[model samples]
Target: MDGSLKEEQILMSSERDWTDLPPNLIHLISQKLPDLRYFIRCGAVCKRWFSSILLSDPPPQQLPWLIEYDEQFPRASPLKEELPFYSFVTGETGSIPIQESHRGKVYHRTGHSYLLVIDGEVISLFNPLTNEEISLPQLPSRFDFIWPVFGGADPSRNWPWHISLVCDVGRSRYLTYYLDRMRWQCFDTVLHKTCNWDGMLFTTEDHGTSTLVFDAASRKELYTIPPLNEETFGFITSYFVESCGELLRVSLDYNLTRNIETYIFLIYKLNFEGGKGQPHWVKVSNIRDQIIFLDHLTGFAVRATAGLKGNCIYFFIEEHCRSDRFYNDSTLWRYDIATGTCEPVPCPFNRCSWFVPNLR
Candidate 1:
């Protein structure tokens, strides 16, 4: 306290009235603030700061908003649990309540105003921000769930949206939906996992060991990453994420049998240099000061704060326990990319999804 006061006295000694600074200078100060908490605090400091916060965007790269849920959706929220949004920059978690009218499983995030959901034949897009909704034609009777394959350089009218869903379980049959033509391309292919930023779709073979990507539009084989080196644990899984324009592969290792209390993480970046060359996995020592947010199925990466450290991964750690007495230790965790270590994070949420608050 004394040190802070001393510093303030030293600044005041200059005999300069900071509040008299022009609005442009004040705006520049707000633009330089990377953390949201400090940004909000600056707004309360004075009129100029408050105006700057409201007039400008928080930052170009905002942290992913994590939304928490229970074991399964459509379950009764006896407690009326509220969804929490955690920010990596501020190291704070803020909750936004789910309305009583809002029900059914949150299938997938479509946009800032829409979330795509499917219930049997009915497929709808609900906007929780404004409580508005728009329902499209019912999905084909064959597909059980809808998974969207997004990202690419050309996301305009050229490529609307590429989605895949399971049609037949026994035959391992699936179909891809192209929005431009309003047609479903049905085929039996590898487990259509995820896609990258360049409109290439990726899949795994040999029991989730190898990765192969192909052009979704041309239907031509692009290339494949090397086979994954298995981890010691039996419950290891891999996921592909489009991060800050680069493609990243993350391997998560955990103990399914028991809560052994440790997590292993390996992060690799695909090196693409020299225009058209063979792409290979490179062990990333740093993520260029970014953090990857991972759920079970899909994940995204964002610019991490300097205080939080870079090359680290944030995971929604689900703690599975015995006795089945309705207990779960679903805590947020941070895994260091450089040291290969894991630790508990301060933010807490049960069913959280990566979200960005509706600024609109």
Candidate 2:
């Protein structure tokens, strides 16, 4: 062939019709792509390419796969930085910025799309997707409101559209609030006697406890956990991780022996659908090395960091001394249950009381 003709053939080959490729070959290109944008670019090459990529089996496993440690890995000087938030998919850090700090502050994360925030007496439901927030009725602070815990039906399930909060005051009083209903109801449970301000409202897929919602107008604990016999208490703390479709509760007992204090970590699976509570809890970790639960991390023990894929629980381990609270330098570590390993991830902030993963 002529030299000019040969050069033209090479150019045509570079622009070969993407439709000529098989579906599997197109899928390989999508998976092998390093980032989401690149995968998207591949789909834009041609109509057939886009259709094949989208229709390919196993769909694109685009849910955040890798944990992106912000400039803040091996987070040291805990108090110096606020909790770090990031997007696992974009490898972005501190994605959500709090322009105006509210009075009640954010309690628990509902999903990657929404967060439950308390402002004064009212509850603010913030949606990251719409970038808009709605205000709910003021909660009875005296009753001691429960944190909002959320989960979906499954990976194929719809995004969570509602939330529940269970409030308890003193003893023999309980209340439950459902966000969808925008109302409060009263129920009685065996736990009425065992319930305390520190006693948390538990939920899971099977036999889980419902959130106690408080009525500011009634000024009473109205909701109660049924079949309370299934409910057990020792040291209870709950948190939801968006990266993994699961809610985690760390229960432990701390007792002092011979002037030494010890801590144990027990994990519980939350049953959100069946409203059934699990009788047995799973033990995750235990540190007997003269460690005391710092008063700061008493209620909310575990937090999920943003920008990571998979089930990794970020715990703020406080080093306490008999003289006073362990403030100076705190260590943040990631406990990866899948790998059964705990390693320190770096953070860029200081004096971080809690970690809010960036939801971008």
Q: Which candidate leads in lDDT?
A: 1
User: Model 1: runs farther than 4 Å from truth?
Assistant: 1-22, 33-55, 70-84, 88-93, 97-114, 117-149, 152-192, 205-208, 257-261, 271-279, 318-330, 358-360
- The per-residue C-alpha lDDT of model 1 at residue 265 equals 70
- If scored against the real structure, what TM-score would every candidate get? 0.68, 0.43
Q: What are the Cα lDDT values of the candidates?
A: 0.57, 0.40
Backbone collision tally, model 2: 48
lDDT of 1: 0.57
Q: Which ten residues in a row have the lowest lDDT in candidate 2?
A: 288-297
TM-score of 2: 0.43
lDDT of 2 by residue, 1-360 (tens): 899999999998889564799988888776665445456568788898889867864323233222222333222111112333433335455433343443225344242234555544666666432346767667645344343433332222242333445555546454545443455433334232111121233332112344442333343654542422223333233332221333334433222221112333345443444545433333334321111111122222222222343344455543432214422242444555455454545543332333222222
In angstroms, what RMSD does candidate 1 have relative to the true structure? 6.4
Writing each residue's lDDT as its tens digit, candidate 1 over 291-360 gives 7777554566766653667778887665432213322453677888777777766666556555544332
Question: How does candidate 2 score on lDDT?
Answer: 0.40
